[model samples]
Target: MLGTHRHLRGLVGGVAVVAAVAAGAAAHASAAPAPAANGAAAPAATTQKVLFDDTKAETAGNADWIISTSIPDPTKQNASPSKETDWTGALSAWGVALQKTGDYTLDTLGSGNTITYGTGGALDLKNFNTFVLDEPNNQLSAAEKTAVMQFVQNGGGLFLISDHKGSDRDNDGWDSPQVIQDLMSNNGVDNNDPFGVSDDDLDISSGTPTAINDSSDPVLNGSFGKVTSSEIDSGTTWTLHPSDNANAKGLLYTSGSSGNTGVFFATSTYGSGRVAFWGDSSPVDDGTGESGNTLYNGWNTDSNAALALNATAWLGGGSSGGGTGGTTAGSTTGTTSGTTSGTTSGTTSGTTGGTGGCTSGQLLTNPGFESGTSGWTATSGIINTATKEPAHTGSYKAWLDGYGKATTDTASQSVSIPSGCTTANASFWLHVDTAETSTSTAYDTLKVQVLNSSGTVLGTLATFSNLSHNTGYAQHTYSLAAYAGQTVTLKFTGVEDAQDQTSFVVDDTAVNVS
Candidate 1:
């Protein structure tokens, strides 16, 4: 699903004929219009061709689509990294398969023969109906930006994948930030600044949840599941705030964190071209193992791959199947593919709720906070202590402060497992909200460890550091064993710079097994 054009050379027999007949009928109906004075009908509008840039020679006549990535900045190793090869490989397989069912092509463009934004390079966007900005990290040059804007404004289709944190590697520091700020601003999007986690270290373990907004849109109208690969060692989930522009429509949002934050997929009019923006690149990375990895499976099965195909088809003015289409007032098309529908019969169902309250086990909370009537409490004397609240709330809530605190706070709670239970799984949702704290410097030492009944440390479940704690939550799940019937103490030792007032939070504490 990564390459530009996938060539399918073969002859169609009966299926092609049937499809042609259906297409002809639909085309004829859609072509209806008025006749001229001379009694001759006006020529049908030309179908917009989706042009893939061939400057890189990765795509030429073989491509009906193309993929592009940001040029790596040599000075910065931590800047956005390019996954051109991986994207190309994935897209190529998808393009080849799609060609069997439809008339289309795919291609690729890279640094050497890259299509300059305004140079009118290999891609004559006017001839194309859609373009994809796959994993672009560097800021587009002024001219390139203008060209893309023009293309999208001219009724082309566009799909954009913004990078996750650290995707861009520029030593200069200014390169990646400047580039993203410029691109988003030009697109009429106000960067999201939720709860102040924007500047914190990136959260790498968060699950990839689809945005709740615009689930009905064709591009996202299906029950697409998540997949993970082994290549990606770790990464964090992200939230995307909506733009203020009226024409833009928010399509998706991540779940379990602060509302109005998380990943956002949106559609906006860029003149004649329709543009789709995916807030994060984690779902489409070459390396798997991370959440949302299913997006990179074989082109034939991956939902993300199907979305790419639908984008190209819509951009080319092809028949709308998966629901996406041009914005003509009253158009009711949904996405053409990637939806899941079915039902099971005669199957037993289980209760859809959290495990029962702790009944026979011991409850142990962490230091730096005190137990309150409903939950743990933070003292008023601590700076920003008001942010700390009770930790454990039923099975759905954690037993610790979900956000980090500058000063040490105590977290305590009670738990009781069934008397006969021999084994249990202790897990909870941990939101590393250190980014929301008002600290100018980065803090790296945040620790969550478990202790046995003898006060000896049993294990450490999570650790995060060297991240910009601007404001975003990181979810952590830990496993505990050998202490099923005994109560154990859990502790949070904040090792961040005291001068910076760095701390962390833990919530949604639970112990269960089924």
Candidate 2:
């Protein structure tokens, strides 16, 4: 599809609508933005890692809340299970579903293992996008709790599953509720109830989950399906502390309860990561597991299956259980989420990635230039590592056109705005230095534009000249909503005169979508 181009109104606040033709340079201007890498070359791709905890005696008793019987990689039992019975675990359906997606790599923190961060362990908390603790019977050590809290504070997802109070499967004196509460109130990180979601002590024999009127929530209405009412099947409930964590909110509630009390499930954020709380593990139990173990197939009784899968996907990252996963463009992306309040997910400034039809997050890869040109296509020598023109943040910056002759330099990256997103914004910090002393004439110029896949200019977001130079870096942001749902290239081109030299140093770039 052809792209719609917008003209830059001025230095800022430009929002003009216009049509763009198959673009080429003017009679004496630079050529069109170059095509991306030849062959199958694309942005670097990445997979979200999820580590399910079994070390804390998850299988100590009749509670078989495990993705698969096989430790670590679940595929050891079956490469892919068409049905829940294909694997010998109560939560096999959950593991198999994520495995089939191919966008996630699931691992089990088996018995006797310890949760850690920055230790470089293959299964360290830092290595995973999401950490799952389903009905853990053993209380976390002080260090272990610190690791989990620090992980969430530094851009990681946390999934907390709880059981009824005093229901200690391992008879270890601790239960899921106490353990989870301990992690929240007694950790090295912010200890004042970080996520603002606590497991209620009440053991609900059976009840129905009443969905809040939130349709945009990826967990309630996500890829797995819509969550209307879920089965309790011997579960507990959660009480939210919205005052402690302002982002905390209830998604599903118990019958007749409202506000912050009697919350069946809650979600919140801490620092740069996300937190999700579920009252019980029964909804995740697939029922078919090791024989002789009494299990309930609550996974599909109501909206339990959808809630479990969607919550997992949401906790894993991106726009919940939706957004593009494997990409032709090598994946230069990460996942982030918001609660039902849409504090993180539903903002005017969209993020980079999206799944299926839904999309959000920061889109540009190697956005800070700290990774050199790994995800960008730039003219040779454009990605600068030298310190002549300081980067906005890190050591590297994209330098275009410092030659004291008639020359042109360009750099760009291609990104896809999923069809589901309604907003997209491109932003970057630029430092312009020039030897030219023109008070009125615009001798050297740099243009930031959005381009079609075929190298056609879709929109001219901004233009900077020698007159626009400043002592420090200036941030420029443009609305790219017109190019939403399209694979468009963000291009920056600089042109210079034969006498004066002007350099366009750019760093910390991003294309956020929603």
**TM-scores for every candidate against the unseen true structure:** 0.38, 0.57
lDDT of 1 at 155: 32
| Candidate 2 lDDT over residue span 1-514, tens digit each | 1111111112221111000000110111111111122211112133456789998998887888888888988888888777777778888888887777665678899999999865657777756667899988998987788677656544456889887777798787898898888888877444556576777777788788788986656677766777887767567888776434445768898889889888888877654356788887888888888877778777878788888777766565421111212211111122211101111111234434555555567877788766667788987777766655556665667888877778888899998876777556677766666777644355887777777888877655555666445555555455566566699998898888886677777877888776
lDDT of each: 0.35, 0.66
Estimate, for each residue in 1-514, the C-alpha lDDT of model 1 and write its tens digit.
1111111121111112112212332332321112223222222233323334323222222111233232221112212223333333324333333334324333344445443322333443333345566544455654455445444432335665444455444332332223444654542211222111121124344344443433234444321222221111123333332222223444444444444354344454422235565544444433322232233432333355544544444344322211123332111111111111231112123233334433333233321122222433322222122323212222122222222333444443334334344335454333333332322122434444556556565444333332222122322333343345556665555454433233344443444433
Error of 1 at 74 (Å): 28
Q: How far is candidate 2 from the true structure (C-alpha RMSD, Å)?
A: 17.9
- Give, for candidate 1, the lowest lDDT window spanning 10 residues: 329-338
In terms of TM-score, the best-performing candidate is 2
**After best superposition, candidate 1 residue 117: deviation in angstroms?**
6.5
Candidate 2 to truth, TM: 0.57
Alpha-carbon lDDT of model 2? 0.66
